[model samples]
Target: MRLWLAIIVGKICAFASRFFKRGGGSSLPGSLARRIEPHILIRLLEKATPALTSVIITGSNGKTTTARMVAEVLKHSGLRIVWNRSGANMVNGIISALIEKCSIRGRLCADVAVLEVDEANLRHVVADIKPGVILVTNCFRDQLDRYGEVDTTLALIRMALKDAPPGSTLLLNADDPLVASLASGSRCKTMFYGIESLDLTSGYTQDRNTVTDMNANMNMGMNTNMDASDMNASNINASEYLPHDARSCPNCGAYYEYSLITYGHLGKYRCPRCLSSRPAPDFPALNVVAQGAHGFTFAVGFEHDSEYDSIGASLGLPGLYNVYNCLAAIACCLLLGIPKMIIEEGIAKSSSAFGRMETIQIGDRSVLLALVKNPVGFNEVIRTIASEGSNKTLIVCLNDNFADGRDVSWVWDVDMERLSRNPSFIRSIVASGTRAEDIALRLKYAGINQEKICIEPDLDRALELGLRKLAPGETLYVLPTYTAMLEIREHVRRRSHVREFWRA
Candidate 1:
């Protein structure tokens, strides 16, 4: 009775949301259903999945992209896919998605459901749904207002794993020591995936020497700016590469020593005190045969056959972070028994997600959407844009909306100095969204000249001004947080006459 009642009420709300032209139809209905029936989500999962395989992906970054990649690959594999493609990922959203796919009598037709869950919501969602596969994309300091500390976030995820139903395979990011540590205590099977060799020159570099800061002001911005020192790690004040807030050994609390430095605190590192280290990846991205703005090509650690082993799979996205997401998806599909050729085909043909490195073309004007939610993610995106070596316009949107975590201090951690250092890389910058002025102030502090920066808090006008400022052959890069991306992406979609995000 509860399931049926919740479904009917939720379905009515979802229909009303669409008819009212509300952007995301999943949330209102889902939230209502959950409030109406506390166990509605769990019952929906059981109803949908006795005949279907369910995959849950959660992490600070890359959940949407990674989930999207897996969903597309599964579709190509000929499974009737039913997923929350619009990124509505709470337990409530999961129920609503299942409610849509299941019949009024509660029969399901889908073969798989790829659910992208939010970091904080993982514990609740996993408690209700025992997914066949749970993929943890590398965890980083994200939305401090909501997550508090990354370790706290990790602890929550760890509990989720501990409580996860038995026989579930935990797919993890082997390159991330923090993520790898989840395996130390969890009683679950684990599969790992990571980049074998990162092309740092593409947009970032690793610190080659040892740097220690026992009094490090640890936070999400642990690796904010470590590129200005001529002296190596021998000097206490020397510039250090920052990333992965837990620079000290997780086991012994001693400083981690580096073997190879990649962006942030990722790459090869071993604890000198406890001898803890990064785990070996099962599906390693090997041999970077090709790399650049368009994408990259690499070989997998293992293959279905000898002929398939040497095949160069390409991740059709920019930056090492995106490559990491692609690796996660590849590892996931392989575990799910997807054909290598089909996975490769999907990867090669994969387009950008709604905001992450999305490009919008309006006749001759092109706007690139590189969504930036946290300091770490934002830094990577900035590095990618600066490395392009092209003079472009920048539209940066910073929102303190509920969905955007309500804290805007992360703008300070972004190395806006990258653009300031280049001087010529960003022809002009327009700051938009609720926290536009704060971001503009951040740019100024980074040494960007005030004359080159424009403050337009209104998103619509900011979009117009940004496009008007775009010169021929030059691009406009729209870098926004989650809420900012939603608003900007919607405006661009309407103006471009393209379909809405969920419709696709």
Candidate 2:
């Protein structure tokens, strides 16, 4: 009786969500369903498990991209997968996706389910749906207002891992200090993946160092600009930006010196204090070559699994960040015994997440959507544009909504100075959204010509002005915060005759 009741309620929630235009579904209904029918939904779904393996991908930046790659690789291995391709990582969204694919009788029919879960909600949803494999991409400081700090978020993720079933495989990035530290404590079988070599010129580097006095002044405004010296004094020191070279023993006071640095503090580090360092990975992608905006090429060792036979594969996403995501996916797929050829083919054909390097055709003009929510992400976007070798106009939308950090002060931390330093490549700059002026000010301080900067808080008008300023065959790059991206996509859909397939 209770099983039937929960199903009825889930269906009703699904119906209501559609009627009210509220995004709903996933284990959210399971929460309410559990109150009325404990264990019923889990037992029911567990009984109808699909033949395709289940994989859950989580992290701060690359969850969507990694999940898409894993799904593509599995598809190449002849398995059908049902995934939330629209970048919906919440509980209700996952449930809605499952409900959409499941029969009215409540049975999942796909061969596999590849889910991209939000880091914060991983604990809540993982308990309800025990995934067979968990892939953690990487952890970074994001949305300070919501996540508090990187350490706090990492602790929460650690607590969630405690509940993972013993047999489940944990795939982690060995390069990330925070991620590596967490994986060390897990008892479950773990597989680590990371960049084997450090490209110093392409990686992030700290210009200065600082020390923090934990007790000196906790009352400083969140937006206050502190130099590296002050940042270190405040205990907010920037770790080495190279991921591969970061090697410190968190357990002891000893430092693990890295032979190379990847990004941030992720790299080969050994604790001089404790004699502890990451063990060499069992499976690593070799011969990585950046293929510009089309992704990268690399070879996976097939000895671990015969399913992958191809020597090289290329991904369709843009930026070095996508390369990190692809590496994570390749590591896991190789462990799963996927064929090399299939992995390569899937990667070559895969597209990026919505509003994440997604391109659209507006009449004769091409618009590229790049989501920039934080300084780190924004810096990468700017770097990508710098490497493109073409002069272009930029439409940057800034919003201070709850999801985009109520404090837009982080903009000051960004190295917009680089953009200002280069005037030849960027012809015009258009800023829009509630915090448009704030972004404009940052650009001006970075040395951007104030004459070339245009601010229009109204998104539609900003789009018109920005588009009008573009020359034939020229591209307009759109970089927007979370809410701003949604608004920009809506405006594009309403005005332009072109189809907006990359909707959030």
Cα-based lDDT for every prediction? 0.76, 0.68
Question: Residue by residue across 368-423, what tens digits does model 2's lDDT show?
Answer: 88889876678678767766555678898999998788989878766676565446
Error of 2 at 380 (Å): 1.2
The digit string of per-residue lDDT tens for model 1 on 1-504 reads 877887888888888888887886867788887787888776776777456778999988888898889888888878987788777877667777877777776667798889988877888877677788899987788888787889999998998888887777899987777888888777778888766765544433323232233223232223333554322324332223334576777888887666554455666777777888878787888765335555677777755655445335787676667777888888888888887899888877777776677777877888888889887888778767776665788889999998888988877766576677666777889999999999899888777789989999999889999999877766788998888888888888877876777676
Off by over 4 Å in 1: 199-241, 303-311
Instruction: Compute the lDDT of residue 138 as modeled in candidate 2.
Output: 77
lDDT score, candidate 1: 0.76
| Clash counts for the predictions, in order | 3, 40
